[model samples]
Target: MADPMIALATGLSAVLLFLLMIGLTVYLLWKRRQDMRRDNQLISTNSVIPPCTPVLQTLQASSYGSAEVPFFLPPSFKSSTHSAMPEGREEEEQWKQHPHLHIQRGSLTIGSWFPLGSLRPDLYQLPEEPSEWAQPSGSTVRLCFAVQYQQEQEQLVVSLLQAANLPAQCQSSATLVKLQLLPSEDRHHRQAKAQSKGCQPQFNDTFVFQVSNNSVDQCTLRMSLYSVDRLKKHHLVGHVLLPLRQDELQEAAGKVLWRDLETDSDLPLSKHGNIQVSLNYNQSLQRLTVVVLRARGLQCPSNAGVSVQVSLQIHTQVVKTKCTPETRGSTPTFNEKLTFRLLPVQLDAACICLEVQQVGHEELAEVPSTRATAPVSLGLVVIGPFMYARGRELEHWNEMISKSQELVKQWHGLGAANNIYNNNQT
Candidate 1:
């Protein structure tokens, strides 16, 4: 009996040990899994993606010409002479000026055909020459230039023909012509030196601006002349304004027209307020996000149910979004996020249009009225790449592109719509 009891006790002990071993194995696995999960969490917490560097080569101001091929000197010479070259900021100022002047590879240089100081069209008198031409006197300065809108190519060609009777400057001062399109003075085009005999300088340089047909009527050409001395000090000589609304612009295609320059104090100011927005682009996912944060100092009429609308134009695709529930004041807080599926290639041509509209309470109703009513646009602001955007608008876009998946916020000044809607969008 004692021997049998001992054997039973040993068997029970062995069974208990086996159960203990199984429990230990299960506990070890659970601990190991917990450790692995903690490690994974630590790894994920530390991972960060750095902003991407812009890979596009920096082209000179004149280099941004769409079809005009510049004579690029050797790399060593270009780098050494770049600082001394007057066109250092041409990429930023006149990037949009030349996108239509196509020069064949073997074609003669621009200077060969258009000689300096050659007798061209008379800007002051069209179709007929004045019996005796007299120089413009007093503070008035005249700019002689030619403008043509090519409907087929959608290009606005501006030729700096010549300037006669310019305001006298110090003999050491060299004249430069700064060209920029209004209502948005985002980019400026300049010609370093004009062949001058006294106050008359001849500039046969042609600048081509890419513009859509819809916004052509509202476009205005501003030519600002400046005198830069040997010390690089700049003085405003005068500026000429050519409003596209005039009938002469439509009639005088490639014909020279003379305009009187205005003083610096006469420059116009933006009456429209400002809008706050945020932009983000995810290259890997091919997505774009726009956030309409708020608006301030809006110049809208006092009306009920005032709301803001934001439009995204990607090539021919246009998507619009608006803030719900009308706001009363000129300053409206939207904080709305708009997302778009954009391809990598389409980013270069994408444009954003924001409009302040006064919507009637009746239009906001769910009844869906049959009567068609157009929302009155109070103020408008458009932002995009260098093609149609400048200043803060272009800077915001560039920041968004360089830092993918990162949000870039900016305050853009508002301006009159001026039918800027015709800028190639659906």
Candidate 2:
């Protein structure tokens, strides 16, 4: 009886110990799972609120000036009615609902939770008034003008009028006027004959330009006045630019308009000078030859002579050969030749620039002697790729390129240094 009782006690003790071990194992597993879940929740919270960098914060602050621009809560932070829905699908739905946030300029405020504010009046000022010529209106524009007296110039022996301003100073004894439709390369242009020159010279001659209704906004009527010198070179006196819009055209259509001629900023009121050049290309030798022939209408101080130099540039490659300085005079003749070695493949991208510079004098004497000393900048003319040439320039280039190994000579006009090249590129 004693032995059986002892055995039962031993069995009960073993069973109790086994049950305790199993309970301990289950508690350990549950605690680990709770810790993992807490960690995952912290990670998701961090992802929802991204960290802002210093640079971005500074940019936002500077953009608002001293104004307190509010920052509204993102869609993800906004209260939602569907909070009970599945987590993954709800986040996606919130993003889809608020696809874009429209924020007006200077409306952003700092620290405030609401994005409600009127745009600063100073920040949202209206743009500048557009030019009358840029207005888009479909109305026929008729431009009429008469060449009136030009004030200021003393030597007015002969004069010519033109609707279009010539690139180089005109070297023609005959005074004539030319008018052409804008942006068209056609040969349809109007002209008027040359007339004798005088202060307040009355042209009394009236001309008209008929612009299309659609193109009236872009059309500009240019009136150029040229004086004929003893050498028969047409020196540019001055020009006037008339914008042809519907309102201005309608108001001035029947009435004769007289306005003062405005000279180019670089060119003097009295003509400075003009350079003449001849271009020839030899296909067989792959050489380009340029001849600086003569310059006319050069203005100089009393008893002071002018010296001139010519430089030829193809792209950035400048020719080592520069023409020798011509004799001191208002009109100097160089008759020097400059040659450049080139290949057929290079001509497509080549641009020829001829720069005529005035040397010898420390400063160019301004007219009337009271004005400040001005630097001498004679003029520059450029001949670009064949495809880019126009009118007479195009004709000249075609003639040269067509005749292989033969010299093709033509007179080219020069304007203020860099003006022709800059205008062409623009």
Candidate 3:
């Protein structure tokens, strides 16, 4: 038979162990509740406020032509004393009633041209000369200089042309203008006559200019230089339009005749995220793309995990084209809808990449990303152990959030839920 005292001791020990377990359970419940509250606070504080429809500032100022230019000078120089070396005169008379003329001398040595290197096209102009017979005061004397280049020859061919596409606003006031080019050969001969010497391959040369009746309102020059050797590895000079004049060059203005935006070219979305970008056409591929990415955790959606939602609004250009068939007797109309999509993401801001393409050539990229995407969100995932042990705590949190939401809904419902909710009275 067992001793009564021993039995009593065993019973007491078992009861104590049971009580300890209960205390641990209560403590754990308290901690989980606290953690959940903190998480809720964070989520509430960082809640996503759906972005308002973007007021696109893509009213690109009317553009006409690329305004970049490349100008090159020789690597070395030797200063020669002029009979009357006038300095600072060119600077003073550059903006006077008429252009002040000065003559300076230098030589440029030509090496193999880089296809698109330092030397660039500053500008071109064709001025109308006042006929000796016609004594007209100031009729708009427009000058248009067309610039082209020989890729292989490394020569710049400038010609008198019309800016058929030039904007009217950029046109100058009616006045007389002079069109001229400094003859390189004449300079060479003059130097020869003065020096009393034959031509040695002069690598550098100086130039002189003299003006009588008219002023140089705006002076621009574009020089296109490329590699002289076809096989040598060299830099290809990208075309540039350098403005030599101190003031704004009127020729730099242009217009965007047609623009297309592809709303669907946005990048993949990450949840609870937002993105913002310019609404415009992509130049390279003639397409647009917006992109957004976000990080989400492993929390369960229903119980202990955080899930983020993403939202997007899309805008695109509607183009109607009437292609006149050269072979047919009529103009055929092609009706096309440039379709785009704004994908929804959860948790963080979204980055929407946009792309614009013709229906058949969808594979080719039309443009690079204009900017990063919008309406971002971030997600978090919690382990199941936390959820399983603290299921009641999660329930409690949901209950509280649900109650708050319900109150808001009821309040809004009474007022018909106008967006602003500015009305103070019930």
The 0-to-1 C-alpha lDDT of every candidate, in the order given, reads 0.64, 0.50, 0.26
Candidates 2 and 3: which is better by TM-score? 2
User: Tens digit of lDDT per residue, candidate 2, span 1-426?
Assistant: 999999999999999999999999999999999999988986675423443221111112345476655554432332446657776665465446533433322344222323457545666698888643232222222122532221223111112222222223333344544554444457675655544433323343545444446665554455566666677666666554444445544455343443444444423332445555567788778887765655666555433443334444455665543554444545565555667787877776565665555444445343334322322456655665665556555666666677664345444556556322234557
- Each prediction's TM-score versus the true structure: 0.32, 0.31, 0.13
Model 3, 261-283: lDDT tens digits are 11212223323222222122233
Q: Name the regions of candidate 1 deviating beyond 4 angstroms.
A: 1-139, 170-172, 184-192, 245-248, 266-426
RMSD of each: 37.0, 28.3, 48.9
TM-score of 2: 0.31
Lowest lDDT sum, 10 consecutive residues, model 3, at: 407-416
Best candidate (score: TM-score): 1
Question: How many times do residue backbones clash in model 2?
Answer: 11
Model 1, residue pairs in steric clash: 61-90, 61-91, 65-98, 66-99, 93-188
Candidate 1, 245-364: lDDT as tens digits = 334457887555666665634323357766767789988887787766656666654455556677778766675444534666545655556677778898788888888766653443
* Candidate 2 stretches greater than 4 Å from native: 1-272, 301-321, 364-375, 386-389, 418-426
Residue-level lDDT for 358 in candidate 2: 47
